[model samples]
Target: MGLTQTQKAMVEKARAAGGSGQAIPLSDDACVCLIGIIARDLGLSDHFPELPSDLPPFFDQREPGSLNISGVEFLPLMERLVKLNPDSDTFFSCLANLHKRRLKYERILQTQPIPTIEQVGPRGLLQFGTISATTLTGLLFWRKWFFDIDNRAGQETGYLFEPIIAHAIGGVPFSAKASPVRRAGDSRKGRQVDCIRQQKAYEFKIRVTIASSGQGRWQEELDFPVDCRQSRYTPVLVVLDATPNPKLDQLEAAFLRQQGEVYKGESAWEHLESVAGPTMGLFLEKYVRDPIQALLNKVSDCLPEFVARMDKDGITLSVAGESMLIRRTLGAADDEVQELPDDASDQIPGP
Candidate 1:
């Protein structure tokens, strides 16, 4: 967004040395200047819309007449006014990713999920139900419906979370140029890395708790660290959930065998924030974590006792004698979710 402490220090150093707002030298290898250029095209920065263009006023150049990036061939990917930050906390931020993540949460709220009632089977209820059979049955239905939406949200979040965190820490989602171990008749390419910062290929996961992932998928997971090694990068595994699982153990063992680094739970968050620096860390907490926690709290308090009656069109969910018909389509604007354009931008209009 703006600048990291290290970047600020770089600016101060330049200013004190009569560098003014001038060009910094670009290198062949990954450096702060190149990193900043890559980081500029990302989200989770404090200065999203009203980006401070003047602060990070140093650009990367090879000669007085040549405007250059690390790879001369890829110079076009670098934009004008994209500045150098020693800490890789680029100059500007895009609201695109933040908007996309927010949209996933909004879709979860608007969606009126209705699982098949037949899923309950002949028993039509839980065996442990001692009182209020109807309420318990309704609760089970709600749980199933909620589960569908929750899983959908999780998958969508997976698609968004990588870049949001990756860019915040000045990394890019990487795809290995070549496959390390190609399968027979498989058209698949190299491993899709969550984030690649310099030579560190980071694999980010919320948690790995499945008892056994499918054999093919599990093997692919195991191959990730190997692919990173073959690509000449150090593997960094970041699992946000530390809950012990046999599957996670196996996958982690695979990484460790490849001399990879692993961080779990609090350590993972700390590692992300440590690289992301104070400003981007605070931005992530405020925009990403806080909103998610608030939504979880809101859902848990209400859904724990929710009663759903499903029919052909939709389902009627009742709580405390209040009923609302929910269809598969998006619901009416409520206190929680407001109507927003599909192309949500930095300038969100007041409702």
Candidate 2:
């Protein structure tokens, strides 16, 4: 939060130039950091959660470049920010400055988190305080859906997690439009590299462990590096989990073979945020990682007292001394049970 190295250098430059009464110059990152500090001091972070966290990197010197935002760019942002305020209570110039500050924020959200969540659909509301029957249902519902939906749909939606971080770090879905370097298996279905940006091909994994997976998938993973190198791209691997595994070691070797880079666990997060720049960096921290961690921490505090069971009958949820059996019908997914009376349960049943 204090002056960053870049800011310090600029300060020294300003001091030297002060005798001539010349205007002090601020680098793009330094200017952004000052704004963030000002917002924090003014306690405006609640209005813009991405404020302080997003601004740190600029000060940290991770993002060093000219921030060329012309009026062409400013107009769209001004229009959007203006729309947010229906009331015109002394906010003409304020909105302009506000949008200038939050330039990358809305775009990052629109391009990243919003789309990822849309696939998951809405999580039903939870009423806090006492453990209500409805609250328990929400917990049981997600856990049940995770397994049941996975088995039925034959999809691992957790794979969606990788793209979230990759895109946050400026990598986009591997497409001819996104990058010129396409890997051997660049088809939409048999996607090889997780994403690509500039001349780097990225492979993102939540974790890599000793546990064995499909040989075909392992082969594809191995092939990714070779394919990327062939396309004149550097294959970079990012794994979020640090759990040590021989398989992970092997995978690292694969990337090393291609003269690529590997980042795991804390380093992976650091690499991602550093590359994400200010706007997308905040998006990763605020909307993505922080929320996920908070969710886990919240759940860990008082774990949900809910259970889900799937049988030939169907899926059933039992929580708060109540049971709801969703019976499955032929050619339709449940589609199963009640364990006890609903005397103390909240009246949240679909019926």
Candidate 3:
């Protein structure tokens, strides 16, 4: 399949920023870097007899106290190695190891401090100036409470929450309600999943009940699709609330017992408290915060298992100028893009 518009735009931007004619495509640098590291860590040549002698040179290029070879240069070498032993368990293990290393590197980057105005040169300053202007515009736009009244009414009908949650979690909303297949002699009903992130399905529930019977019904709602589609995607239940419901603990436990997952108001509150402060944290946790933190936690927990499974299954590894997008989009629909909330006014303080 061809690259999506967003992917194409990224390539174009990279080229415009002097990334042209680079041996490694700008986008695949991190993956390629991790690939080299993983290969050395796994001792691919030593373990896999089929590995070509030239493969060692790629890893040998690492200089002490200096940058390793660019992913661009490493790409063809990796591709050749994969072709040499396409079905080797040791080869696929390196790919899984690469993913693990990349995840750790990304976590490190997130924790690092942002560059200051002086630290960033002229180009960086220009980028930050645009970012600051956009942020201020967003703040002023959200300052309008009067416009939110109508927007809240629209939200109550449950038309916009899925897109909002999907956007916040960096996931795509599943367009169709139910899978194409139907249970024998049973009428097709709408599936509850609203959004999907990292191969996990998420269903959003607003104002769920605290009673035992109500909780049972909610559990059923969350579990059915997961039971049916567990092989394809893991399931997460996100319960949006106006207040902290103590009974949700029971529901969460029940879902977890069934191999399903749950994230409620309390989880959102805890996340916001860390990032947005106590006051705004309480407000957002009660009102507009999406279950992004919960979804991230789920992804982090699942990734190791996912990598192991991929390695065992021997997923097709391509290092020749392919993007990480190709690795992630293996089973997902490329056309199904995540939709962002149309207006900031859509968010209103809950009672």
Candidate 4:
């Protein structure tokens, strides 16, 4: 097939690196075919069935029964492929293979005597040590989950932190009401809280664009709930913004500039502390400590009733107790097992 401009450039680069008199075991024609296969697999091209007439003469020349390329040559080609098609499934698959290779390489290294700082050079040792420490800390897993596309459904409704908090707490205790309730003799209807746990109200806001007055627009939205005296529920406000504002500064600063404040305006922050609550930072810390176990805890608490309902519909609860098994398998003995109210549903509000 006709090489795309990118593929042609990649070929030229490889030839330039190979230089004159460099005997590459793989024929240029074979390399082109391999590139075509890779491109098709990555969904980069659909014209792989037929070879194009306009291919460079280098690709046309061939005296090959089998193709071979050294690891040095293959590495550059793979790097180029990854750079060009990062989001492609083929690229991810290749990445996964590379990870496997890395694990194998680590195993080989482990068999040898551990190198001293002087032998490996202090900078090299420091880099390896930092990576090792980070991997052990489980930060990367949480970072991946935070940025994963599938988990971004909550962003649209300004409740992006709800799911993570809910999972950490083991279940969602309240559903978002479509309309706010206006009680008798009230000046305005009470603004709806995002979600409630144990009758304690929570509001989630994202301050991406600040208003002209150097304050978040959501700050205005908080006035009703924060000032609602008639309501029995204690309110808490969670804001996701990076700017320095008095409201956020007064609140407990979460990692990455996120902030959480228990509605201390009319009620004490301590009022909601006893009722299934954590500052946004603490909740995130727990989540980062172990997300799989956190999620499994949520599933364990919520899945029983779901399994029962499935049984009524003639569907089997095949995965019963698996969440607990996962927790045990992962050696998560230190995790606090939360038992949510059986009647509380774990479903979060959809965007």
Candidate 5:
């Protein structure tokens, strides 16, 4: 169906009128920041039925805080979007072409140009700069499975050990959507292997942590992937800002070493060759840097120098940013700091 001439004109009119309510025009960076946040808020689902119009008022806040609109309650939501660009990119990148079902509009639109993940899972890999946390959260959210452990029995060290074990046996624990098969028994001990491996499996050597503050005797734990015996499953590692308690990273590392030692003669169970970089910092950096950088480039009137300062640490744009940051970091290791700049202290504030 094609958009009726009347409908097309109406949409154009609405879009044109979209900014008139703006008391002050948003910077290019600000606009993109707004869109990113808006997209995320929409994704959250608690606040439903959002339209383009809901954003201008939020963007209109020109407060002297970390962001262009520090007074706005939605600033944190916006910041999360900025901080999770790679995840956001991966998400938008995965979306297919836009389609409208209206009988009035006949145009079948191709997806907007977004970066593509050439190889993901195992053969395909992608990077998350400052947006590491966001990317991980997004990966979990997108796949319908966040990193959940068995806190009930506390037997699995309060983390999901089954999936970790599966990672050892050429199985990949993807977000649920990426799972090859979904059955009633996925959460079970033995069933996970069959369900995960039945589809294409990619291994993520994630730096995982477990806290004992809330649960049982597992004081703290950190685990890192040290073996890729199951390379047939896509293999990648997710590094975090700090090591978890009980030295899970060391444990996994030792496990790999032990495996190598044990199977040295029998078969190859070698660790992966790391293409090292600033893993944790870059992840957070991408979260804010990419959005601020790109957004500044967009607004004709936006000062790049001004937006650059927004990336500075120890800054909080709005109360919302503060609260949301706290929520996201709730279960994370205490040592991991929110590296993304919340306060644009150097920019002389926004409004």
Candidate 6:
């Protein structure tokens, strides 16, 4: 995920340009056009490099000048996908392409060890225990399907509400529906209230999977209530390195085809929640933004370094702004798994 010689030069050129003191706002289409130019220049066609472990950059210095551009920073390029000549095909095409790159990044991290785990059995039992004796609230839910008999066709009708719930909470429903209230005055107790109340509550139990790493596994389940009538989710999924802890894990979800089956399985919600502890939104904040501040260390010219990394990490240009100051995280370290090329030094010679 480091920068190449060409990318380094591109950024340096922009640094020398002395840009207009205005932040340029590009639509998703503009972002893609920029990325297309970059990809071609980088020779990323037949094969693109895997994204670096340190992804989703966060930038701080919003200066009053034109920002630099480079091929290595794919996120800015990707932001343009929504801007292609014909919107429909390009938008989806951009998403699918980015998703594929994400998966490659996740696979790279799955093999590394930040913590350990042990698989118990296939009744689908696994365990995750914290290193220190600490209490952590792990959320859980289950994925389920209920069928009711339809009198008209003498066939069963499927209830399709669970997926909507799943998309929102990112966990299976674990809470159970309340029992139906007794019919109004069937016996002779007292009141005759003629209205029937329908209980629309359901819970999903999540089953978890643990790798064979040698460490005690902690297990817990939680219930997330979903009202299909209440909300809608922007069904997006991201794949990248990083192990799933009680707090978070990378998710591989899709709104289409078999990939959607990633949400299937009985009470597998427990497993889903174990991973769900972490959301992509959270990563967008912590990993990208926090890290940028940590890298800047309050120095100004070094701001460009932060910018290059930001573009490398996929920090949306629009969101980071043109001139903003980033404060360093209290004790952040350079845990970068890959090293960026010295784009600042390597420039082409003029004839």
What does candidate 3 score on TM?
0.31
User: Candidate 4 lDDT, tens digit per residue, 1-351?
Assistant: 233455444334333312112122234444444544455444554433343323332112232222222222333444455565532222222222222222222222222222243433434443455667545334333333224322222221122234334433332433323323233245354444455555445654443223444346445443434333345444456443334565554333321122234433213222323333443223333322234334534544343532211112221222444321100011111111132222222222111
Quote model 5's TM-score.
0.23
The order of the candidates by lDDT, greatest first, is 1, 2, 3, 4, 5, 6
Model 6, 186: alpha-carbon shift in Å? Answer: 30
Ranking by TM-score: 1, 2, 3, 4, 5, 6
lDDT of 1 by residue, 1-351 (tens): 444455444333322212111212223222323323334433323323232322231222122112123333222222222343332223223222333334334445446444555875444544545757776666667777677666656644554566567766767664343323222234365555677787898888867877545887788888877777766788899987677888888889988988999998778878888887876675455555565456544554334555667677766778767777644564432222222212221121111
lDDT of 6 by residue, 1-351 (tens): 433454433323322311211112233333333344333333333333332222221122332121223335444334332232212222222222222222222222222221112221221232224322221111111000001101111110011122222322322222212112221223222111111112222222122334423332221111011111121211222212223443223222112221221233322333333432433223222423244345434545533422311223321223235433222122211122221122211111100
C-alpha-based local distance difference test score of model 5: 0.27
What TM-scores do the predictions have?
Answer: 0.50, 0.45, 0.31, 0.26, 0.23, 0.18
The Cα local distance difference test for each model comes to 0.52, 0.48, 0.39, 0.35, 0.27, 0.25
Per-structure clash totals for the candidates? 0, 8, 2, 1, 44, 46
Q: Ten consecutive residues with minimal summed lDDT in candidate 6?
A: 140-149
Error of 1 at 188 (Å): 7.5
Q: Per-residue CA lDDT of candidate 5, range 1-351, in tens?
A: 333344333223222212111112233334343444436433542332232333432222333112232333333343444354423322211110000111001110011111223322332233445456556444533232111111112321111222322322333344333333233223221111211343232233223455334433222111111212222222233222223455455444544442421112111112211111233123223332243345545556543331101122321223323321111111221121222122111111100
In model 4, the runs with Cα more than 4 Å from the true position are 1-160, 170-190, 205-219, 226-228, 239-243, 247-283, 286-351
RMSD of 5: 22.2
- Over 4 Å off, model 3: 1-157, 177-190, 211-222, 225-231, 242-250, 269-287, 290-351
Best by TM-score: 1
Candidate RMSDs in order = 15.6, 19.2, 19.6, 23.3, 22.2, 23.5
